[model samples]
Target: MNYIYQDILIENGDVVLDAGRNPVLIQDSAVIAQDIKHAIIESGLSVALIGEKSRDGRADLKKQIELLVEEETRLVPGTVTLEEPTLGNIWIFAKTREFGDLQFEVKEVTN
Candidate 1:
């Protein structure tokens, strides 16, 4: 069986628009990437107080993200690491049954 996923593309919290002002579409890895990114953002907001200052905190956040993504999307999560804690940079690695390996980053902005 062939499985293909597709959705309207969104960028920077806004729906991407073309020259004709039509919503752009994305499929496969792009769709999955957005899904994972949304999951991470939601997880971060849900656990706003959880800082990645300690190993346990990082692990907890990672687990939370994994659970969220797994429950929300088709991607199977791999390793979630805080590549740069100062800037709130998080790296996520996951894969879908149809789309091999996937990697992306989510950055948390603080005031």
Candidate 2:
């Protein structure tokens, strides 16, 4: 059986509304991306508490994110990567079943 996921669209911490002032609904791959985005954003525990300055902390954070994404969404295992381009910002790259690739940036978590 196939499943179709649906959710309200959100951007930059705000719900996206259509011209009629109703929340915009997204389906399928877009919903998957949104779910991934929420998982990353809501995993708000400080990396410092997890030892962010050390290699172990970074690895731990990556593994934690991978687990959270898999737990929260229908994304296939091993398809998510958490990258830090600069300090305090994580870039999440993932692939959905139908969508080729999805990327999200999580910014400014206190280190």
Candidate 3:
């Protein structure tokens, strides 16, 4: 199967197909953890594909959702703010140490 990293759409464990018929997987926990780390280092954001119901007659498809991002929060300096209605997501923030290491803090935000 081929992987499309930029914009992925998944509903639970299902893969959403693209125009070119490329297969996309939801990826397990281990892969997801690594993906989040890479995304934070590379783009400052981690994106995931979540399966959502299609209003139309098409099959259920996944939509790209931000799993983590620096600006998702109201974005106070040294802080991240997320505006979620149900607030079921967990976010983690990390600061880069002088030695090029990272120190992390986990926050749970709920509406």
**Top of the candidates by lDDT:** 2
Q: Write model 2 residue lDDT over 10-39, tens digit each, in one string.
A: 886889999999999887777877767666
Clashes in predicted model 2: 0
Error of 1 at 33 (Å): 1.6
Reference-based lDDT, each prediction: 0.65, 0.70, 0.33
Instruction: Judging by TM-score, tell me the better candidate of 1 and 2.
Output: 1
Best by TM-score: 1
Each model's backbone clash number: 0, 0, 7
What's the CA error at residue 65 for candidate 1, in Å? 1.8
The CA lDDT at 19 in model 3 is 80
lDDT of 1 at 66: 59
lDDT of 1: 0.65
Residue 53 displacement in candidate 1 (angstroms):
3.9
**Which stretches of candidate 1 lie above 4 Å from their native place?**
1-3, 45-55, 76-86, 109-111
Estimated TM-score for each candidate: 0.69, 0.68, 0.23
